[model samples]
Target chain A: MYYRSQYPRDLFAELDRLQREMQEAFDFSPSIRGLARGSFPAINVGGTPSSVDIYAFAPGLDPASIDVQLEKGTLTVAGERKAAEVPEKSTVHINERFGGAFRRVITLPDDVDSESIDAKYRDGLLHIAIQRKQEAQPRRIAIK
Target chain B: MNMNESTQVAKAAEAARNEAAMLPPVDVIEDTGGITLYADLPGVPKDKLSLQVEAGTLTIEGEVALDVPQGMEATHAEVSLPRYRRVFTLSKELDTQKVNAEFNQGLLKLRIPKAEHAKPRRIEVKLT
Candidate 1:
């Protein structure tokens, strides 16, 4: 495993590139670590029969600054987490929080209805729900 | 090399790797009077966060509640850990009894003041 540097930002970028290549090679899915590497804010994608749900773990950010875009069956969440305020003349022992701009893209299933989407931000978690196509939903036909 | 020992070693390494993913990043700042600590705890609400100071030790624990929406099951998930845990030993010079904490926008801020006795003092001298 080769890493560019100890800084989390660069390290994550390296992992992201690696993961993208792997994804193309083997159709890999993001995990907790390894391919995912806890990039900036972690993301989770799930779905129900009627709608697709996406939960993005983005903390310490203003909801107004976040940009959400849905285009061509792809959803993108982009935002910047401002650096926390630190008092002057203080000794900083440990600083591990990643600060700066970040963006995440999630590709939804083809059945997802692009017209209907709902998003909310609460407790640092951004949740997006997109309705599925009516024709794609599972159906039980009455016995004739 | 014992085979069982090697297996145990691999398991320990894997556990460490997994734990690192869950460890919340924290910043500890120390000034003359005391120390201020900040932690990023996303998706954790006030009811789910627990901060405890016991026997000269401070522990921060936050649990992320993933409320699966009604009739929805996760199809793909990247974040798996539900809890964040971190522990630290406080300096004896600091007053543990008076610790202030506030959580807003998923960030936890804690301030621990220095003990009264630990403050700097100067003595006065008179000419004889």
Candidate 2:
């Protein structure tokens, strides 16, 4: 099975070109480093002998809104945060906090086993655990 | 669950907002090398807070509001913008002496430059 749209003979290639342009624009991370603008969530990465740990820091964000997935050695985090209501009578002097939607995508090392990833959210932090496959584990070799 | 705790926190937050004249809360993020912080000071002027990194800890203490807004009264307040208080433990890989901070657009951006060797670098793949 494949996902490709076929167009009329005259517009076949042109439509394909347009689709490519749209894909490029819609792609989450276009940069080589994969960093995007607007409120990048903080992340902490640690690894044990058998697994790698990743944590994302996001306050005031509901856990239900968070989406985490691991595929092709890339860890993706997508979520939205709504603005808190401020009463009409309250006069505001300073408004610095940003409210809206935020999405962050990170690329992981090749050693991670995509299917074996596990995750949990707590205390405004999303913790993800990816266990390494046996072949990817570190092993000491004896000299002859 | 954090969500359940947040409700209780919300109540406490509301109370704190009523008690304090201002709440200058700061969100902090730290990595293996250094720490970055975002402090929300709605009415705090440039001259209020002095940013300094001494030894291995960052100190951000500042006064938020000298006087309440001219024509405003606190009723059912939820935003507890207090005096900004945030502390961060810096890693040894950070050069605390050269830390820099700037406040613009109501957001304080602090750049604690990391040591040269602490940054990630690519290693060449060679074939023998």
Candidate 3:
């Protein structure tokens, strides 16, 4: 006879909680939608069998001030962008630059190698390289 | 051609030149320590972005265009538009090594770290 057991209800509840948190964390909606006052950061995620690549478009922000964290298959990016310097005696008619505190989070399914992750910034773009988990790569075995 | 006709031609050429000179707007702010600059440059790629600092001013230039392909007509474009160009003056306390910048979405973030001498520090106290 074969014995089978189902997952505990607490474990299922925990999984549900995590899913809710993930949904809240990765919301891509802007605070002021359809308004020209702010520019929402664009993001791209690409992956191969052995690696995953994430790109964030953020300019004029101090790299040191920005923070990136990954936990429980979730990626969180947060930072504060200072306002651009303006001359004392200049009057401006139109202002369309975005400045303030901003935060973005994403949930990833791929097993990312946090230790091997690499981040690079150039021309105002942040590129993150995440090595895929070894088990996530497909393989074949010969039968004896 | 008459002198008036030649003058009109020159005026027309000058107007064309002005129309073609469409540079993005920029703002530079100077504080007691350093300067901060903000530039509006949409659709600028990392390879095309360049910054040059000569004399006392820093110049940032990037080329961006709405690529509608060879035979395609522009129906609508609301994502990104044109290019951005801006410049700024650098101060002495602005540490170039610590100067950090990032660009997300379409916003450019630049931080000119203050010099060691300019940054605030706290003295530790020892009790006997």
Best by lDDT: 1
Whole-model lDDT values for every prediction? 0.78, 0.56, 0.55
Interface RMSD of structure candidate 1 (Å): 4.6
TM-score of chain B of 3: 0.55
Chain A TM-score of model 3 comes to 0.66
* Residues B2-114, model 2: lDDT tens digits: 99898998999677434423333454555544545555443345677656677777766555432322333332112233355555677788877667787642356675767
lDDT of 3 by residue, B4-75 (tens): 999999999577433322244445454444445556554467666666666656666666533222333332
Candidate 1 stretches greater than 4 Å from native: A1-34, B1-21, B120-128
Error of 3 at A138 (Å): 1.1
List candidate 2 stretches off by more than 4 Å. A1-38, A141-144, B1-84, B87-128
- Better model by DockQ, 2 or 3? 3
Query: Model 1, residue B62: what's the lDDT?
Result: 82
Against the native complex, each candidate's DockQ, computed on alpha carbons, is 0.39, 0.02, 0.06
Docking level for model 3: incorrect
Indicate the DockQ of the complex predicted as candidate 2.
0.02
Error of 2 at A126 (Å): 1.1
**When only chain A is evaluated, what TM-score does every model earn?**
0.74, 0.67, 0.66
Candidate with better lDDT, 1 vs 2: 1
lDDT measured at residue A121 in model 3 versus the true structure, 0 to 100: 65
